[model samples]
Target: MSGWVAVAGLGPGADELVTPEVMQALAEATDLIGYFPYVARVADRPGLVRHGSDNRVELERAAHALELAAAGKQVVVASSGDPGVFAMASALFEALEAGPAEWRLLDIRILPGITAMLAAAARAGSPLGHDFCAINLSDNLKPWALIERRLRLAAQADFAMAFYNPRSKARPEGFARALDILRQECGPDRLILFARAVSTPEEELRVVRLGDAGAEMADMRTMVILGSSHSRLIERPGSPILYTPRWTE
Candidate 1:
């Protein structure tokens, strides 16, 4: 076919954070498809058709993109943050595998962007400098039990952890439960950083001890970083620097 599909990341909120590659893909796209907010990021122009859908219809959106591409449409799937990192890239591939054989022959590309985890880490002075792992705290797709298990295991393994979707109105209590688990496994003294809306005008950063971290500190827009046993802070004048040492003895 003469058409292609590109799953492009819009990066963490800031227009400057968006990579040139994604911008180019967006410019070349004849049709743009993704969740409403993400698709809205790309300004409308002549010859560019935007297909915005709700957040819950990932599979449907992916299938639509594939169908459009198969019919010789240049499609771009917009995703917030890195498309491959807990975003539309995986959903697109899942659709491809379950789709017709001819869909596999269509050109597909994944464009990377600055993920919220990394953006949050930078805003809080590199809490992820050492070994780290990212876990989505929302249990929309996965079970709460699995999320709890992973949280405990990650703490036990001494990995500086980044959390996405830390809290939401629908599942507000989950983050509180998570904090209780963290306090139990990592103790009250462990470091935690809450970064909200990184690189945006509404950005806010807060660092505190595990005991001091309230569930209200994080909402869906916040990225929470739980420091490993080796993570520490350097206090000088301004907001303290939270960093995990490269060498943990």
Candidate 2:
């Protein structure tokens, strides 16, 4: 039997949030691979082999998944949030040359799920109704210079921003620099929504000014959004949240 791999997104880990198709994909997988924290999210899952690794070992993790699949193990390479958006799907494809051609030869499927950005956006109200972009503040992979370039473009273009991997121990200044750039372009009045640990028990969402959302209040678990000038905070009797891009025109 030829080897194949399914890159699956397990959603935000609420059983209800997990879609039927993703559940079916997980049920069909013989071997599952993911980051340790994400692996823990599905720890109760049954009848599957788990390969959990530290965050820094993405290449190793992808290589291992390919190896297992090449051995004809029906592998599920899982990612929290969406696998395609700044997650395992890219690593898997990049690591293709590191594995056998046949293993890379078979069809590799990427199944989408609710990414943290979308989940947070929904909970906090719409911030991406029009043009938008996402940026990962982890400067470890891409240079800070490149990140700055993208942030500048996104800001100038007035794209609502969804920031991922906002801060890590080594790069404490990433989000700060990003915030600085946005503030410079969009001004201090811009609304910056910080959604920490969204969809989990520890979830917290706050709307702050672009000048105020800084690393002192953010960590790797945080997903920060910078709303465009068109965004607004609406207060209904039971709800007070941010909304963006009035497309009524």
lDDT of 2 by residue, 115-194 (tens): 98999999899987777899888887888899999988888888889989888888887777777878888998898888
The 10-residue segment of model 1 with minimum total lDDT is: 117-126
Q: Which pairs of residues clash in candidate 1, taking residues 3 or more apart in a chain or in different chains?
A: none
Each candidate structure's TM-score, on Cα atoms with residue i matched to residue i, is 0.98, 0.94
Off by over 4 Å in 2: 43-46, 237-239
Q: Ten residues in a row with the worst lDDT in model 2?
A: 98-107
What is the Cα-based TM-score of model 1? 0.98
Write down the lDDT of every candidate, Cα atoms only.
0.94, 0.83
Q: Top lDDT: which candidate number?
A: 1
Clash total of candidate 1: 0
